[model samples]
Target: MASSNFNRWLRPEVYPLFAATGVAVGICGMQLIRNITGNPEVRVTKENRAAGILENFAEGEKYRENPVRKFVRGKSSEIMPNINNFFSKPEL
Candidate 1:
């Protein structure tokens, strides 16, 4: 009985209202999650703006000098190199 009444109340004429309410609820839910996760919404500020620009310029310089080195560092490679050395062959 309750389900039938709910279906009757959700007529096609009220779809726009349902859609708007759904969008508002979704936006509020995302804001709640972002607050809980502590993610910064704004990246730029007066304190670090100049430092950020200088770092970007320095990175461009390094990229021009040695692209391969820059790629490795950018990927944060952490694999260790091999350590075994080969010995000289004995006379036959």
Candidate 2:
């Protein structure tokens, strides 16, 4: 009985339909969650704003000039030579 049940589950026709239905259900569930959480509009709005030619340029420039950014930039410059050395070596 167990072997027959396993054989039925291993049938190609049955498994394909089952997998398709499962994928459809997962997609539908994701859409449902996005709708309930308002994530779709938030992502669309962020993309639209970013697509503007000069909308956030000043804000981004200010962020780059901040003190924390200066510290990170200094550290990155120091580390870059070591990183380049690692990547420039030939394989053993």
Candidate 3:
């Protein structure tokens, strides 16, 4: 009867917190692995650095424009078509 009570405490409904804690630990482990393997300064060429900065700036501009486009014109459907097309495409 004591063992049965212990098993019942381990049931999913009673132990979601444990599962969530495990997931958080796993994510931290992966991040630690990434940090260990990642390079701090490989020294990108000036041209490549400029290109990367420009690309990131463009992405930021696009992200900032998204809400303005949606609210100003209210045309969410325009975005959906492109997303649908991306998912529908077959790789060559």
TM-score of each: 0.37, 0.34, 0.33
lDDT of each: 0.60, 0.67, 0.63
Which segments of model 1 are wrong by more than 4 Å?
39-92
Tell me the lDDT of candidate 3.
0.63
lDDT by residue (43-76, candidate 3, tens digit) is 2566654554243555455545654476867555
Q: How many clashes does the backbone of model 1 have?
A: 0
Tell me the tens digit of each residue's lDDT in model 1 across 31-54. 677454432332355675445434
Range of the 10 consecutive residues with the lowest summed lDDT in candidate 2: 35-44
Tens digits of per-residue lDDT, candidate 2, 17-73, equal: 899999999999976875545432333466665764654566556544756567677
Ranking by TM-score: 1, 2, 3
Highest lDDT scorer: 2
| Per-candidate alpha-carbon RMSD to the true structure | 15.9, 11.6, 13.8
Model 2 whole-model lDDT (C-alpha atoms): 0.67
Pull out the clashing pairs in model 1: none
